[model samples]
Target: MKFLGALDDVSLGRTQRCNRRLTDPNRLQAIRDTGLMDTPREEAFDRLAHLAAELLHVPLTIISLVDANKQFFKADFGLPSPFSETRELPIDASLCRYTLEGESIISSNALADPFLKFHPSTGPWGIVAIIVLPLINPEGHVLGTFCCIEPKVREWTAQELKVMRELTASIMTEINLRNQITKLKTEQNLRDTFVAALTHDLRTPLTASKLSLQLLGRRHPDMPSVQTSVARVNQSLDRAERMIQNLLDASQIQAGKHVALKLSECDLHAITVQTLEELTAVYTDRFVLKAEGTFQLMADPIGLRRIVENLASNAAKYGAPGTPIEVVLGRSGAQVTLQVKNQGNPILGEDLKNIFEPFHRSRSATESAEKGWGLGLPLVRGFAEAHGGRASVTSSAEEGTCFTITLPLDARARAQTRLELLTSDRVAPASDVSVSTRE
Candidate 1:
């Protein structure tokens, strides 16, 4: 039988080939990513360990995860004493680490083996015979081992070795399946939250608008208070309109279609000024605008207005109360840029990546004074992208959160180009012509 020659070097304090693979950064990262390190023993892994012990006819079994600092017994089946309670061992003391770069390591008698005789688990803990199968993930990184240990000397059969290998593969399969299910569950929870918030958001504005209209019906049109009620209803409807448009645009984009825009010559600076003016009745004295030059661009007025409304409204909602929501408009080369900056708790780096996704509300957003529909930023992105432009954001505690939209000076040309491309790509036979038109 082959003995572990590297163990001799380890006793004399020399780095061996197995140690090189054992401390690999990628291998360590795979173990970390599993989220199993130092966690409580789980029944699923325990059951697998039990099955391994039964199949391999061993007194102890372990589903181990090796990291740089330690080896955790994720499934500590029948392990005795300090180990059963602690479920971990220092990396150098862990026998499982040696199997990381090998298919399997079988020791007939740990106490009699030339190199393993001095190992603690064997020499002191009465665990003598041992077999270890490395658990390599689909990405080819060896995480740790599925090990079976016994107190008495025993030679592992070919069939027992095969069983250990199959069990090790099952461990990785279980990990992958568990991770996929967790991902699906998280997405499902997010969808459920989005639906719940969307319903409440849609109902609030409509209910307010209805109440305002009812008030106007009883009050005389010439009454001073009637104008205020009308403005209130308009603002409520505008909010509802933006939400609805965003939803529809999301659907269109999902259907593999661009947000069809009606592009025309419009002043971006004028749109920002007007949007702020309209919002003044709601967020009075809350907005500050700085415009240095004429920022005219060929774009959809309603789309651009929706962009301004969504961004400015978002700022008002998330910004600190009574703090100014600043708007800056300027032309850079042949494109116009609009920046809306607000002061509030900065967005977290992790949450920023998914901030513009439909139905994504950041942790800061959830904790803010205002609860939003989660459609505003996504809508802002949809319109900006559909108009041959892009939307980007930056957030920091010192400078505040700012969303910038950069749109080409002539976006109508983009729509025209897309239309031409579609027309040229769709030459079909007479029978297929009708189906083509349906697009």
Candidate 2:
């Protein structure tokens, strides 16, 4: 009926108006610039929404941010669009606004509510019922709303409301964390910008000094000691710059800034070949990447390369030089693992636990003299976790240390692509394909 269509228009208008207010001509740029959703956070929010949908027995569930002008879906399931404009309704007409108006729950039997009478979203979609639960932080701020829509008209019981409340509580916790991270990132960006400017200022003098030293070196080729001194000064400046960048990286991690993966379905052999080609310049000795099949993995080439680089670099620095550093990729069913092994003084029993922590140096590590702020392994752990996986290290004096990271492929996406293989050929179901191998 026209009711459903009218509601769609109303929602769209409300969303657009909210967007305009939150992102006014000048403020719009800043609002758009603040990218609040990253992969991990998005996954967590989706899980929460799933739980809400299950509890409410609704076909659709949405965790949406209702700003002054627009309704932004942070996560949604069973909905055509994860996002849509709602600029048609004023703030007073919003179910989310009702939550702020001291209502614990906003439910509507769509057929009976005059407010939704013109909103055609209900009848056409067979959605006769709806509810919106406010996701409020402990500080009494409404972050968003967890909404449920059903095709059938049903009564919500106290127990169901309680379950929704619990789910929304978890949603609030996640939002609060996101807010804290947002504030931290705002501060960190400011810090990074200031540091970059300051460093630039300092670098000008260092560059001038280096240039003047080069002139001195040419003028006095007989005095090698003066050249050595200039070289040392140059080295110190370079080290300072590296340290600053490291600090920036640490801040990014703390701010929960993630490097988005440009993933492709590429065979392990190709990835290994590419990794080896890049590693040849730094690790010309014995570097091996062995794998069995042409199994494909969805991975960001750059991020994966960084992970391999860090592990290989660590092995070269701490492990015995000229010894073999082995890289192996293996798959088991739905999981894939990458491991790096080297011969070195194995991790002591005590050091294994804290090795992945930031700024932690292993007591048994022989290369303390090799410069590092102890952020590498922690950074590795963050990258692994970001991909819904983990990084682990095991070592013994006899066998040396082996660092392993296990990552899960995007199963749903893979299922979509591999359905043909499963249906046409006598191939193992994607769920049943397991190849277990270890180093």
Each candidate's TM vs. the true structure? 0.49, 0.41
Give the lowest summed-lDDT range of ten residues in model 2.
430-439
Off by over 4 Å in 2: 1-247, 364-367, 411-439
Model 1: colliding residue pairs? none
C-alpha lDDT values of all predictions: 0.77, 0.64
Q: How many backbone clashes does every candidate have?
A: 0, 31
Give RMSD to native, each candidate.
Answer: 15.7, 14.3
TM-score between model 2 and native: 0.41
- Candidate 1: deviation at residue 325, Å? 2.4
Error of 2 at 258 (Å): 3.2
